[model samples]
Target: MTMNKIYSWQHKLWNKLTHHADSGANALLLKGRAGIGKLDFARHFAKFRLCETPSSTSEACGTCLSCGWFEKGGHPDFYHVSPETSANFSGEAAVAVDRDESAGRIKSKKKTSQQISIVQIRALSDFVYMTGHQRGRRIILICPAEAMNAAAANALLKKLEEPPAHVLFILVAHRPQQLPATIRSRCQLINMPMPDVVQATRWLKQQGVNEPEACLAAASFAPLLALTFNDQRYAAQHDAFIEQISASRKINPIELAEKMQQSDLPIVVSWMQKWCYDLLCFCLTGKVRYHLSRMTTIRVLASSIENKALAAFLRTLLVSQQLARHPLNPRLFLEEIFIKYATLLDSNGVKRSS
Candidate 1:
């Protein structure tokens, strides 16, 4: 769909960006947490910049020829770079490489790469150096810029260093720290804003999402991700996972691991992380963050565990999150974490089943 307007939370940032649209910066880094509409904002800005007749508010004129080309995903001056397995600007998918089996399975029969290769970066040489449609300014949008491998990142760094005239590079990264320091320094870094709970819930309601607050918390306050909580498959899986984990005393780590082996490991680990975070938060501050509906269970569990032990477990989850992406055995990986969690609870006087 065409991005005609920015999100409500983004109006101020939009004004700030448009006010300096002609500042002559060739590259921009739109970095922030995932699912907050940074990509949509970038698309809107690019459309505005390419519009032959922009509005007084610096918005795209939908009727312009440039706007038409952009909406059709065939703009001569617009280029998008993403991992081969990702959806392109036109919503088309491609194949590349498989980094980790346990990181998450793509579900495709053909293995695909999750990285933006050097070839894709080098391919931009033609688009960047060539003449644009009607000789207007060109825009290159690279989303999740951290997905670029070392070679690809270094290649893009060169272009950012000696950027061609009349071209803008917009790099959108959920984890900007993962991007090289040299690459980050070469562009205009824009820290995208996060919508507050009220605004995010309102937006989700406008999108017809029920239980917006709980969903919002489940997604760590990322509205777009919270939207996925409405999906039947994902919701069922997440609910089941949480329910089983809540029964720490009776949870069979091996069985749970087998049941969720097909799921994304990093995501499963994150689910555990959020659950533990809430448990710890309740123990210390008497409040819950993610599992808003499970206050009673969290309260009971929090009282059973020591703050120091829970905090240490939380730190281990951070390391698990990293290795989850490249684990050799997904089942064993899951079993190990679940077992540790059950043991922690058991040690805290939570009786374990035989």
Candidate 2:
């Protein structure tokens, strides 16, 4: 359940967390931008806490009962929560009613549109307060913890303030700032940054990604996005997005956003991130080797911008990405970005025919 290959820094942190030598925080909050091996790290931590014979100097033995259940993903004492709006699945997963000693598993591909509800939090609280099912402590992992609605947050806050003994909570979040102040104050924050391209490249290759460079090009070193980028399901759609941006060069920003909403937004944002990274790489390296998803497009893109301009474009891309998440109209957000990108390229004396 741990990263098959752990990096040096990750290994150091893993050691402290496992051995509890870094003992200031009972609850560890692993927060980071998307795709920095946080999930993998969390998995490793959970496995160690649930280890039947947690040793001082070695990783968990796969032969143990707890490790076996972890591999099977059937351990009742371990709980992992994720966002209700998770793209990996169609619905939300959470604890069962009353958090009573009930056995519920993380359900992906669920179509229900429920957020982490108050009931789920109550169940979690009760479960943590109850006795452990095994010899060690019970572990609760609430990921993308910001996705919890108001009621759920309140319920969770109470538990965080007075968590039961031998119950460990690991909260994973892409944006910790979005969490309640109480929640943030109650736990220890661990920053997980995005991996460098070299680290990313190595990890991708280890994942058996044949075209790891291409995946990197397509995802801007966001490992989970790169993982999803291995296929071409959204390739055509990205092309369509480029076409939309190209055609919106002179259009009003708001109008442009509406027109740009015809394609899948998440995938487009991912590409935009990759392109920004590629433009930066090109500006520095004078070569574009990693952006294989649209190497030709990036090559053309690189020739048109200086490093400053590329940085600005990346900023706009970040704006677009954040705006894509707000309750704002998606179309307007998309159009604004497309227009801005087109304007940037055009001002740089590079024009793509609409």
Candidate 3:
């Protein structure tokens, strides 16, 4: 349960932030792409602010009483807000409740919510308005802030509009645009930095990742996500999915959909999106961004794919991505997308095996 330490790429921003630690801005927004460690950065900054004695470099002293409480997840003055179903800060996978059939009785389990609720926001009033530990500064961190529903966002807006004394709000968002304009306006927005390929690849290597470059590219250059690519199970799934999709003439949409229905829908959609993106990219620029290991296959696929149809399918994938999070029938949802893709290839004269 160690605290999230600052990464090498964050040194410059860290110094600038710590230098302006008391700039009188009650609310700060750390907006960036996912897997760039925005949440970790926010957590580290919060720990530092609450530390009784920070280091010369403006980092939290790990041995301080405040740091101990923060690390133990019992800091009285610090509150973390995220979706009920999110494992955003815990560095774990969120598990969905499964139905139980025991004692010859069927029990239905309620699905965990993926959106922050108004109740969660209202509950923050007590912590925000109350005195801090030893009357020191208090911090409220909301991660993936866009998860707040409309009502919850409105409740939080009231606090940001008239923030209490000695309280700071740190919002980490992967898609800040999803947040309301007023909420964005109330905070001092900072676009979190992204590491270059060289820096990212170096860090991944230090993490003992094999084929770091390929993993990095597969994650669209997001280094943290590249770590997941190192997982053999996940890597195998991605490779198999890509192989089936690449051979459009041999794809069995229904069977593929059935096999993938048990997997994370949004993630599967993202995988397809990346593969199709490479195909489209190859068609247009004589290059492939992702699927570098399958360049020969991508080149052949790109040659037969109609640019207009491929582009249209890519747009369709965007809508699919949005609906993926809460699909009523996962199999049907995937089937529809895969069927469309098969039809697209068929229209391009990709004949199926007899």
Candidate 4:
């Protein structure tokens, strides 16, 4: 299988990183917001560096022996480490990791952790010290570096401290601030920039997404995430969701919760947060952000909403977002959220606490 190509916007950054591959930096941290393709860029760069004979553009020759192993995710010199919940971890890689676990390693019967554990990091550290299966550069890619717990981060820190020769560490992180100062200071930071609206929309359209502008807006103008929303049919549902919430007085919490049960709770909560944000924007500046096409609806809703109540609801959604990954009855969670939203339009102007 061929690796997914990096987005067009990442070309310059890719070239710069590839040029620095020979600069002898052992650790590189790519930090940015979601959907900017940092991991994809890192993957392509790693392939290029590992390729016995790469193309003129410093891209991997897909037919090379090294490229074939990388594509199959069986490259002996490449380690792709991520949390189980991360989208970046392929099913094949998951199986391979399980198969390669040592007999002395502690095993857990419970679900694979969503976090990158100390065990995984320790194993990776050991792997890097062992003889390579091939005589070329070795690379370890750890995505969402924030997922590492205190122990795991400390374990990784050791590797960063005593740097290995001919080995490169690519750490892709969505939230760099979550990483410890010690861990962060050891690696070179690369800030991935968000693509402009025109570029984002054009790329989104090329992927055959409908209402690309609206989808991009809903995703905070992140093209890759916009494509995901479109693929999952969330973009189409967003308009109807906004319409439902705009009519806050008639909102049915149970019905709305049931309708959105299929969607991820965090995503649903995020959409609610964005809607409330737009309401506040309209209330303050008579303008909108995410829901640009719903200016009239937003303005009317903002007018009817009690400012205090809306503010409280917005704070409630923030808390909800934090708990989205935890165990919860999705329907009950959504119902409670929608119920609070309903009260925002109440004539009594009552503020509720979570």
Candidate 5:
């Protein structure tokens, strides 16, 4: 099928990756934020490589043998490897975010939809080594790249060093730092910018989200995530989380994360991020993005947090985003984060902590 609805930026990225798909480049790190169409870009790029028709700007004529298999997800030559845990989730794009459970929550079922492991890597490698059932190149896609452990990463590296003929590797990640530097260096790095407010708002509208601006502000401009807070379910959750933040400056970020493990992390991060973003606005211009929605709330919250505290708060939030990549102990990290948040806010005279 014609890629009639892809974002413009994705088009440019697709062309860049396509150039290497059929050439000497054996491995490609399709890097980007959760949204910004990274997965769609990769899927379409792989499709183009498998495309029967290769145009200067696009790929796959949609009528060719390659396109048909792709449409059916039955292509013998191509394999998509991602966290088995996230498999059932079918979004236009798939993103990786922090997974939190109580400091000692029940262990995640080693089920197919949770983590990307060495087993999955091994299975794909076996496929890539063997002959393809089709005439085209062999393609393997591993997404949310950070999900792989050291063992899995190394397994992938061994193959990267001695890649099979006609075999292609596409790795996608939200937090590339969690990936081994060796693994990252093996492929071309493509940065997918987070969609701006305008693009995000437009996408939200298309999704039939009411009060798109609230969701946009809630997501801090991340479109793929904007869809989550676009509804009442998420809106109420957002408000509840914010109240938790407002009530206790000593926030247990990891605890919160663990409590809402089955819930969406992007939304949690969005709530926290937008809170700081509002402080940012108030510090800079004394107004929040959605004055009609959360501006009043932010204004009251900001009154308790001056510029110095606001800056520190945002810095901690940024650091928390980085710490989130350490899948080692999500609970401790999150709790400590809120303690620090509470400490900072308390220092500024707000009893936001327990």
Candidate 6:
């Protein structure tokens, strides 16, 4: 609940939610794009519902015992379930923040796993049947609900099938399609509101972000993502990647792949996918969605790569993204993709000087 500050655009939804503070809905699923504040809204709503001395509008008073415990990250009646890799989880497994030196000490001991394991779901079953320490509503918040694997989702489904009195389940899903149909059907769905371009821009400026428009485009209009987009190093690396890939005739596939070996594979692949998407878009209609700032370069590159070859490379990128999550040799993986990309423009293996 500590990081549940709502954005300006969510005012309407917030007002609507206040009306249903005491509703009998056992489960509420908030689904939307990543960085649109669905999880934060859930946390805020949960805190408001559990406050012993809530205001007339049902907002947390912040001075009550419940508010204090929740802020300190030890509210007995409150439970947060997410992927092990998610930093929102509490206790020794909490994700470390860079602001504190000691935070890394514990986090370095173990790499956080990505899936919300079946063990976590099973544990929730026991907690659901148990009494709330404060005789209040027990709130269980599952963030990025799609992180649950088949076994974990099945275990969670059992709890949803048998509702416990005085208990509430709040599931926040960024990609609801990834969730099982049965699990999604059991919850009352709330689609998180998407901010208009003007509102998102204003919010980004308020967060002190430079080049707000460009950042928003990069994040696909996710305002929260635009706010946190301050990685200068990654921007430089991406620019270099674009340059290399655009001038495929002169670039050395092996050398470029080796340079990117130490970089984040998933992000690199994501950027490549976006780049390909823009190329395809340009090939079809001379329009670019993601790399607006590089329109001229994209236009030039789009004309060079075969439309059919570009389509096939997009599929390769999708496969690479899935494989990037698992253990694999970075150099070899990157090399293979780069080699395949090189073949698209130069099947003769001829290296032209820039």
Q: Please give the RMSD of candidate 4 to the true structure.
A: 6.8
lDDT winner, 1 or 4: 1
Candidate 4 residue pairs in clash (backbone atoms < 3 Å): none
Q: Where's the lowest-lDDT run of ten residues in candidate 5? A: 97-106
Task: Give model 2's TM-score versus the native structure.
Answer: 0.69
Highest TM-score: give the candidate number.
3
The whole-model lDDT of each prediction reads: 0.80, 0.62, 0.78, 0.73, 0.64, 0.73
lDDT of 5 by residue, 327-346 (tens): 35555655665666667566
Residue-wise C-alpha lDDT for candidate 3, range 30-60, written one tens digit per residue? 9986667777788889889999999897889
Give the RMSD in angstroms, all C-alphas superposed, for model 3.
Answer: 5.9
The window of 10 residues in a row where model 3 has the poorest summed lDDT is 95-104
Whole-model lDDT for model 2 versus the true structure?
Answer: 0.62
Evaluate residue 215 in candidate 4 and report its C-alpha lDDT on the 0 to 100 scale. 76
Question: How displaced is residue 273 in candidate 3, in Å?
Answer: 1.7
User: Which of the numbered candidates is closest to the native, going by highest lDDT?
Assistant: 1
Shift of residue 280 alpha carbon in model 1, Å: 0.6
lDDT for predicted candidate 4 compared with the true structure:
0.73
Which stretches of model 6 miss by more than 4 angstroms?
1-4, 85-110, 250-266, 315-342, 345-354
Root-mean-square deviation (CA) per prediction: 4.2, 7.1, 5.9, 6.8, 5.2, 4.9
Better of 3 and 5 by lDDT: 3
For model 1 the local lDDT of residue 115 reads 67
lDDT score, candidate 6, position 81 = 82
Q: Find the number of clashing residue pairs for candidate 5.
A: 15
**Pairs in steric clash, model 2:** 98-123, 99-123, 256-335, 257-331, 257-335, 258-331
* 2 against 5, candidate with superior TM-score: 5
TM-score of each: 0.86, 0.69, 0.86, 0.78, 0.78, 0.82
**Which ranges in model 4 have alpha carbons more than 4 Å from their true place?**
1-4, 85-113, 236-263, 306-323, 326-354
Number of colliding residue pairs in model 1: 3
